[model samples]
Target: MSDHPFDVLAARALRVGAYLVRADDQGRLYDGIGLKPEHWRRAQTLLADAPEPWQKLLTSDPGDDRIILPNGGHILRLSSNRRGRHEHTILAVIEPCVCSKPLGQVLSESTEADSGCTNVTTPGQCNGCAAACLSDPITVECLLRCWYEDLFKLGRQESELTKLSQQLAETYEELNLLYRLGQELTVSGDPRCFVQSLCQDLLEVMSFRWVAVKLFDLPELSEQLAGMFVCEGTTQKTINEAEQAVEALAQMPQVHKPAVVLDIASQWGHLLPALGNSLLAYPLYKGETMYGLIVAIDKDPEAGDISSVDLKLVGSTASQLRIFLDNVTLYDQMHLMFLGTLEALTAAVDAKDRYTCGHSQRVALLSRQLAEALGLPPDRVERIHIAGLMHDVGKIGVPESVLCKAGKLTKEEYEIIKGHPEIGANIVKDIPHFDDIIPGVLYHHERYDGKGYPHGLAGEDIPMMGRLLALADSFDAMSSTRTYRAALPRERVLEEIQACAGSQFDPDLTPHFLSLDFSEYDGQVANHKAGDPGAQGVAA
Candidate 1:
């Protein structure tokens, strides 16, 4: 028999309560049964006891050989040629006696076979013996084995697919959480508020007893910590413990080093008893400047270990916070620079008319105060202040002769002065970050009743900032001495403003401007004159 035919017979023998063993040329035995520990021992003992028959099978003729053991178990050795070599042998062990019936009938009755056995032979025969008598035992065994293998393989595939689905779901949720954090961080302008918001949003996705952010005054190792922002889910005691732990770590020599995760108890020894042992401290840095540190304390036990995904999420969030901090710092520096530039530009315009040396500055101060009294937000008030200072910027293009003229001029000269608002607007329009101040600079001369210059933008049609600037500009011009006239009395200036509310000034803002006390500014006007050589004899 060939080795393939012998293998088929051996499998059938296994179905019929028999086990198969193959011995290689090296005398090593391979159990064809499931090879439990007991099965392997039995196979080894059986071969050891029947040494004569085993030796005869290997050295003598290639034929069937049988050995009857002391326990009445029979071992049949069948010789087979594998790959044209007759060196392989198959041993089948059957207890007591071999089944005379076919193996298929034995398996169908004894085991759950895929197909039913229809042979109606030998009444009163045992189920094993009856199934063994089936007509095509080899074909039946093959079909049953194939079905079992396929079902087992399918079960394993389904298990793997379920794991992949769960992994995909977790990844999607992490991405969504990070996206929400980005939105919250970007919208807030205050650093402390951003840190507090960061802690609150992080709680939604990650489990922690407390979270805190501590920022340094300077990005230097020796600088003192400036502020600390925190959010807590536990008691204040726990928050304090976490803070202490972070402070101790920051004071260490490795404070300027990379991020570290440490066991709170081991690292600080009862400093944070309320917190879990796992604490994550990530440094917030932009280049070499270490801005702050983000600390998450006492990870939830239910969340298991901190996974790689958790680390990646925290690291990315820290990067975003660092970016926002850098932007805010840069914006503040640029804001100071912008203010200085505006001051220099306005001084040049003031110099052209010595009588109005401090006129623009006073107008800016009053416009800012009036805007605040009107309940405008802080940012809007600031824009109005800048606009008031630059409202006369267009006069830079007018002849200094015309601007400093001592007496009323011809209609031609007045027209030349009226065009300054447009000229001023054009000059500042191209300067970067000046969009908010453009309208006021261009339309501060516009009248409330459609009678003023450049554009006859009337009433509410005028930009709100422009309307506010007009009131400030006109009041400063009348209250202070100009080349054409002496300074008007405070009451007289107030009467002029009150009478022109509807026609010259915004009706809604006129009363608000009139409500302000001019006496408080008297010292400020005197101080400006004291500093100006051109205002030596000007009446205040």
Candidate 2:
């Protein structure tokens, strides 16, 4: 019994006093209930003096086998653990002794002496003493009954162990689900993509019929993804019904208890999805911020109602999900704040020149439009938009007199003007996430034929942002009023842009810029004239 692995052999040890023992090494014992030193010494002696049939069981493969030994007035049971191993044997006894002499010893003494059996009405049948009942044939009806009772008790214990094993398995799978969700979180920061994947996985782990997760405050994602909808095993009507109920649920004081609407005739039955079972709706939130809600429909009937473990699993992940999205919201706010400050700085620069009051605003809008028209990704398009807004940020370094000059600039003034792109690039070069925007700010004035500006590399050597911004800047510059020239007509600007396709503009990217809608531009320009800031910054 050195290993003592009978923790789940819980019945016998709890009921009487089950002690672990090795069948072969009867002297050694383990996992024993309370027994004095004297009792332990007597226990070892009792096993050594056991009857032939009981002794044979010590070495035999009798799984769940039982043997009853007679003590003074009590009986002790030795039961096998059924594992066929020597160390897993169990000794169960309430109190092994009740009198000075054991029953087996008393019977042996009586069997040896005949004169004491004078009241024996029949052979081997004194009928008065307990020893007479086992006169010769030795039919112990009570011992047989004890054996059956032990067998039944052991069977019941096995059932309890099975239930415990199942609970452990459920816990293991829940941990696995958490691990996978953590992996998903590291790879994709998008909340919608995260929740969509979570719904699919939740169904598999919780054994639920369907799952619906919805976003509330994060509007950076699309409406289709943000709105509540069952991700699996449901229809649009059911999703719409859930969406309608969100306000009512949100208004009500929340209870952690699940609302089980299993009855088809229940009031919510018409709205809940999955005809098979129950519905569980849990709000995913942190303090006052309601990030989202997860609605689990029709939990498997066989799995029964939700347990604390189930709630904890969902709640733990929900808490993490909210944190991820909240961080993104904060990130977006910081980004917007930074962009706002940049707008203020450029508005001050434009303030130095009366004619170019809204020049940066129009260029920013058109550049963004052109990036989209050229099918650049969302992140790239955003960078280009910021680039356009700060395209002429270098003008802040130019003398106010030179910027507002009403005639063509002298050579020295033109040279001073040309240095603005380098000044603008240097201004923002060290700002985080502005690396790509630098080239656009520095090279917007560069031409396609390598004949333009500082470090004028030809063709595709120009950064993509620089290429796109060049086209947009030229378009806006030709159309907008400048200090030296009246705003050119729209058709003439188009003709001039086409004439300089390869020499001044990227021929491959030029067509995409030409096709963009200018209605927004027209409106912004009109707003500029009307003295409404619009996309334009504050007036000089």
Candidate lDDT scores, in order, read 0.67, 0.62
Instruction: Enumerate residue pairs that collide in model 2.
Output: none
* Candidate 1 global lDDT: 0.67
Which segments of model 1 are wrong by more than 4 Å?
Answer: 1-174, 182-197, 219-278, 305-308, 335-339, 358-369, 372-382, 426-436, 449-451, 478-481, 485-503, 510-540
Q: List clash counts for every candidate, in order.
A: 9, 0
**Candidate 2 lDDT over residue span 445-469, tens digit each:** 8889998886786899988788888
Clashes of 2: 0
lDDT of 1 by residue, 1-540 (tens): 122433444444444434556777665565553433554565567666763656455444534456666655556654443444345655655443334565444655544322322222222122544434333334433443453344446656777889888678767766776677667664224456677777766666678766777776674322122555465556346556656656666665444554445565676555545545666667877676665777676667798666666666677778777776766666666766877888788988888888888778888888988998899877788888899889899999999989999899889999999999999989989988888898889999999999998988898999998899999889888887787888887788889999999999989999999898666566668877888855723234
> Candidate 2: worst 10 consecutive residues by lDDT?
116-125
Q: Candidate 1, residue 137: CA error in Å?
A: 16
Q: What TM-score, computed on C-alpha atoms, does each candidate reach?
A: 0.62, 0.66
